[model samples]
Target: MPRPGARDPQAPVATADVSTAAESMPRGQRSAARPIPALTLVSHPTAARIGERLLLQGLLAGREVALSRNAPDFTRPGEPLGLPLGDPFLSRKPVLFVPVGEGVRVVPGDEGRCTCAGEPLHGGREFGPEELARGVPLEFSGRTVLLLHLAPPPEAHAPASLGMVGQSAALHGLRRHIERVADVDVPVLIRGETGAGKELVAQALHARSRRGGPFISVNLGAIPKELAAAELFGSVRGAFTGAQRDREGFFRAAQGGTLFLDEVGEASPEVQVMLLRVLETGEMYPVGASRPVATDVRLVAATDADLEAQIADGRFRAPLLHRLAGYELRIPPLRERREDIGPLFLHFARQELEALGEAHLLTPSDPYAPPWVPAALAVRLLLYPWPGNIRQLRNVAKQLVIGSRGQSFLELDARLAQELRLPQTAPHRTPPPGAPTPAPAPEPEAAARRKSTEVGEEELLAALRAHDWDVKKAAHHLGIARSSIYDLIERSPSIRLAGDLSVEELTLCFHACGGNLDEMVRRLEVSKRALNRRVKELGLVPKDA
Candidate 1:
C-alpha cells in the first residue's frame, strides 16, 4: 500500500477512495491534490516564455504535475541570482535572490495566504512589478534574498599618490626643506628649471603642512587674462553679464589650508599687486564685492624664471618678490643629481608596468632584468641636459619599459636613446685646421704666461668646474669666500673660455664629475688662485650658466 501522503503513479490526484459520487458534486469542486511540477529558474524573458510552454504542455497532456511557484533552492545561498517573470508580449520582471533558509522558515502569512485547498504553502512573497523587473537582491540570515537588481552603481576610486621615490642627497634636501618650512605658514618660493618637479615639492609642502583643509592649486600661466582676476578672487552673481551665480575664489577655497600658485612669475602686474595686498593683509575682495573676506591660507609659489631679473626688467614686482620669497627652496635638476637616476628609473618602470596591467612581468622571477645602465649611459644621461628634469626621466623610463624587448645592457641603452631622441654614439668631429683644440691648450702654460692675470683666473675656473660651479664648495676647495669665488669668476680669462659653454654645460660637467673641485683642478691642471680668481673675474651667472 502507498504511504498516506505518497504521490500516486497513475492518478492525477491521490485519494483514499475514487468511487465517491462525483456526479453529485460541482464540476470545479473536487477532493484532489493539485499536482506541482519542478520549478524553472530563468534569467531572461525569452527563457521564461520557453518555461511557460513546457509548463502548459505538461498541463494539457494531463501529466500528474503542474508548475511549481516556490523559489528554487540555491547551492550557495548568498550568491547572486537573477530571475525573470511576466507575459511574453506585455510585461517583464526581474527578481534578485537572497538566501533565507538558515534561521527563517517559509510559511503562509496573512498577506500571502494561499487559496488552494488543504495545506497552506508560502515560500516567497511577490514584490512590486517594477521592483521585480530590476534584479536588486536582499540579505537575510546571511543569505541573499531575491528582491530586485538595478544597474550596478559606479565604482569608487582613490586619488593617486604623489610620485617622489628617490632618497638621494638632492631629494633629501628637498624633503628636509619641506618639513622645516611646512609648519611655519611663511610664504615659500620654490625655484627650479622647468620640469624639475617644483610642483611636486609644493605638493609635498602641502601634504606635510597638516593645514586641516583642502590644498588648492592654480597655474597662473594657464589662467586666461580676461578671467584671471575673477578666477583668483571670484565674483558676485551679477558682477558681469555671464555671471549667473556667486563664485568662491581660490583663496576662499583654500581657507585654513595651502594655496599653490604655479608659474608665479607669469601673473600679470595687476594680479601681482592684488597678490601683494593679500599676502600682507590676509584679506581679499571678490570682484564687485565691497566687503573684504579674510583668509587663513598658506601661500606656496613656484617659478622657473628668475623673479629678481624680472624685477630688474620691470616685469615682476620687487616688493612682491621680497614678500613671496620668505623662504626659498631651489630644486636641483636631474642632470645635477644623476645619483638619483637608477632609483627613479626603477620607480617609474614599476609604475608604468602597473599602469599597463602587466605588473606580474616585473616580478623577481621574471626573465627580463632592469638593465644595468653603464656609466657611459649615465654620463650621456647627465650630459643630455634634461630641460624637462625628473618628469622627463620618468617619461623616458616608462617608454623604455613599454618598448624594450630584452635585458641586454646595450639593448636597453639603444632603446632609451631612441626613445629620448638621444644619439647612440658620441658625434665624431674633426677640429677645424686653424681652430685651437681644447685638448692642446696647456693650463700651466696659459697660467705662466699671464701669471698676474691668469693665475687667479685658472685657479678659480678649475675649482669652480671641479665643484660643479657650486660657489660654496669651490670657495672651500680654494680656501676662499663664496663671494670671492663669485668675484674671481667674474674677472677671469677662463670666463671667456667658458663663455662658449652654457650654464647647462657647466652644470652637466659639475654633476657628471661628482662636484669634485680636486678632480676638476687636476683635469684642468691649473693653480688654485688662478682658478679661483678667474671664476671671480668671470662672475659667471650661475643661475643661467
Candidate 2:
C-alpha cells in the first residue's frame, strides 16, 4: 500500500518546465504554452521532503498520470501511470493528470471531491494559457497544493514600510509589478479589497521614485464634498466664509514627490472633472483664485470600488479613470496568499512588542526568534480566512501579544478564540503535571439558554430585530456564537425581522444610490448578489428605464 500523499515510483520527478514540456506536444498545439506548469508543490503538510525529491527527479511528461492510493494495472489500455496518494478523503482514484495538446488537463478520478484553482471541476478542466499562467492551486481532501510553473524568477523589490514577507509566487509577482513601475511618474491606480495594503503600495512607489519631496497622503472619501476642491487645491484668504489664511493644497505639499489619494472613487463628478483638468494641464486654480499655479507631483490613486461599474452608472468620469489608470496594480486578497500570513503575523507581533517596550522579552540572543508564537499557533493562523486581510491580522497580533502576557499556549488560544471568535485548536504547550484538568466550558449561548430558559426561535428573532439584523450583535445579545444565529436564519427564512428592509425601502435605496451597486451595498450593508436578487424579486424598474 502507498503511504499517504505518495509520489509515483517510475515517474521522472523533475521541476516542471512549460517550454520544455510544450516541445513534447504536437506543433499545432504549441500555442497553449503556459508560463507556469500545473501542480507544483511549494509545501505539504506531510509530504514535502519526499515529494520535493520526487519532483526533482522528474514528473511524467506527454502522458496521463492517474493519482490514487491503488496500484497501477498494466492490463489497462494506454497503460496509464498511477501514483498513489494517501488521503482518507481521496477515492481509490481521485484525480488524473492527462497530457492534452500543448497543455495538461486535470480530470477527477473515481474518488473524493477535487478542486482545480479553487473552482470545482466536475468534468475535469483542460489547462488553458490563462489558467496555466495563473498556476491555480489544487485541493483534495481539504489539502491545498500549489502548482509548479516554470517562469523567470521575479526581480527583487524592497518596500520601505512592508519588506518582502513571503516566498509565494503571487507575492513575488506583486513585488515585480512594484519594481517595474515605482520609478515611473505616470498616474498609477492601485486597486484591491480593503486591508490588502493599497497605501503600502503607494508608499513603496514614493520610496522607490526619484523625487525627493515629502509624500503627501489624503483620504478623498474623508474630505467633505463641499470642501473637496478647496482641500485638494488649497485656498486663498477669504476664499470661503471660514477662510482665514492662504493654505497649500495636497498637490503643493507633494511638490516634486508623490500624492497618494486613497478612496478616490468617493470623489464627486465635479471633483473628478477637476482632477482630470489638473492631470492634463499640470496646474490647479486655488479656491477663489484667478491664476492657475503650476505644480510638480506624481498622483497615485487607490480604491476598493469598481471604477468600471461606477463609470457605467455615470458616477465616475471615464476620462479621469483613463488618466488615473495609466498603470493598474491589483493586490491579491489575504485568502489568496495564505503563505504570507505567518510571516506577517510575526512581523506585526514584533512591532507590537517593540511598541509596548517588551522587546527584551523576546529571545535575548536572537531578536528574530518568535518568543511568543509557536509553530502550532502559526499553523492555526495560516488556516484562518482573514476576511479583513492584513489589518485584521495586525489587530489579532496585538490582541495575542497583550492577552498572552507570557502565558501558556492555552492562554494564547483562549485569547485568539475570544478576539477572533475562532474555534479552539490543540494547545501547543501541555498543562503542568499534577495540575487539575479543566473541563471544557459550554458555549456562551448554551449557558445563557440554560440560565434563562429562553432558547426558542422567538427569542432569537427578537434579538436579531433588536440588533437591526446584524448577526454579530444578535449573537452577542443572546450570548451565542454568530454561526448559531446564521444557522437560525438559514433554517427559518421567515424569522427575518418584519419591516427591517422592505421592498419599497430597497427601491428607494437603489434609486438614491443612483443605481451604483457598490454604494447600495455600503449604504444597506447587503451583498451585491443579495441586493440584485431582492431588486429582481421586487420587480423594481431599472434606473435607465
Candidate 3:
C-alpha cells in the first residue's frame, strides 16, 4: 500500500543544466520530457509552508498512493518537495490514488472530503493527463489546495528570485533559465504575453552579467517610426531639426551593459537593419555621422507578437530575429501557473495593507475569525484566465485590500463580482470553537452544466441571447466558470471574429452605428480593437487609413 502521490523511483529527474536547457524548447517538445505525475501544495490558510512539491516521477499505471490526516510522507524530490498535510479535518483512513492508463483514479476513504475540478469526491473520479498538465486543482478540508501537475524535478541551483514571488515548479524553471543565460553575453530573446515581466527577466540577466555599465530599456513600439533609428543608434548635433547636442542613443547609454529592446517586433525596417548591423559587426553609425563608432553591448529583446508570422508576411526580418534569439526563454502565463495565485495574491495584498497602515488586516481578528481572504474567492481567483498576467493580479490584490478596508473579510461588491464572475451575494457559515469561520464553501457541483465540455452549441447560443451577449452574466447563468464560457464563445460557430467579418458588413455596421465604435461593437457583436483593426485595414476609417 503506497501513500498518495508517491514518487516513482526510476523517473528521469532534472538536474540544473537539463532544467535550464528545456526552457528554450517548444512547449510540445518540453511536455515530452516532463512525463511523470506530481503534486504541489499551492495553497493553505497558513501559507508560509505552501509550494511543497512531490514528483511521482516514475509511478506507473497500477501503482497506488494514499492520502489522509496522517498519510505517510515521501520527500525525495529536491528544493520544493511536498510536506505532510496534517489537516485535522481529513479522515484518518487513507484515500487511495491509483494510476490508470494516462489518468489517475481517485478513490475517497469512507470519510474523505475533497473537491476535484470543482467537484466533491464521494466515490471515485478520473483525471486525464491533459487536465493534470493544466493543473488539476484539489481543494482539501476547505483549507488547502493541491495542484496535480507534471514534474521533472528541479534542483535548488538558482537562489535569486529578483523580485519574483511564488515557489511553483514553473517559477523554479524560470529561475533556472535566468541563471543559465545570465553569465553568457549572447543575445537572449524573452517571449511572453504583456505584463508577464519581461523587463524583470531582462534585469536579472543584466545583474548577473559582468558588464559594469548602465542597463537601458526602450520600447520600440512607443517610439515614432521616424525617430526609431535615432532613438536606438543616437544622432549627431544638427543631424535633424532640434538635434541640440550629440545624443547618445540607448546603445551607447548601455555601453558594455545590456540594451533591452521591448516590443522588438514593432521596430521599423530601418531600425531592424541598424540592430542587425550592430549585432553582427559590433559597430554603429549614428545619424549624420560619417564614421562608424565601435560599440560593445549585450542585447536582450522581448516581444509578444508572432515574429514568425511577421517574417512569413515580410513585415519583420528573418535574419534579425535569428540573431536576437541566440538564446530564448518563454515565460509561462499566469493561468498556466494557477497554483501560485494564492501566494501571489497574499504577497501583493500584504504590501498594500502595510502601505495603508492596515497591516492588522493580515491577521485574524480572533482565533475564530474567518480569513480576510475567503476560500471560495480563492477558487475563483485560481480559475481566472489572467490575460494581463502578474501585473493585473497585483492590481486586483490592491483593490481587494482597499475595497474591504472596514470589513472583517474581503467582500465582493457588484464591480468585483462582475470582474470575478461570482455573485455579489455569498453564503455564510459559523465557525467551530477555537476555529476561524469559513465562508460558505462552494455549492456542490451541479450535474447539468458541471463542465464546458458538457454544454452544447445550441445551449451556448441560447445562454448568450438570454443574457444579451453579456459574457459575465451568461457565464453565471450557465453555471460555467468565466474562462470556460470565453472558450466556448471562441469555439461557437455563430460568434464571428473581426477577421471573419466582411468589409461590406463592417461598412454597413459602421454607417448604421454612425461610426461610433461602441455602437458598432454592440451591433456587430465584435471586440472594439479587432473591429477597429479590420476597419483600418479596409481603409474605412479615415485617420487610420
The order by descending TM-score is 3, 2, 1
| Models ranked on lDDT | 3, 2, 1
lDDT tens digits, residue span 267-316, model 3:
98998898888877778999989999888787889997767656756889
Which candidate wins on TM-score?
A: 3
Candidate 1, residues 85-192: lDDT per residue as tens digits?
Answer: 222221122222222211111223332232111122235333232322212122121111112211111113311223565433345446555665666557778877
Could you report the Cα RMSD, in angstroms, for every candidate shown?
34.4, 16.8, 14.7
Predicted candidate 2 versus true structure: per-residue lDDT over 375-398, tens digit per residue: 334444544556567888888878
Per-candidate TM vs. native?
Answer: 0.49, 0.53, 0.67
Name the regions of candidate 2 deviating beyond 4 angstroms.
1-162, 355-376, 408-410, 413-415, 418-545
Off by over 4 Å in 3: 1-36, 53-63, 70-94, 110-112, 154-163, 166-170, 357-368, 406-408, 422-545
Candidate 1's C-alpha runs over 4 A off are 1-163, 360-383, 405-545
Error of 3 at 364 (Å): 4.3
Best by lDDT: 3
Global lDDT of each candidate: 0.50, 0.58, 0.69
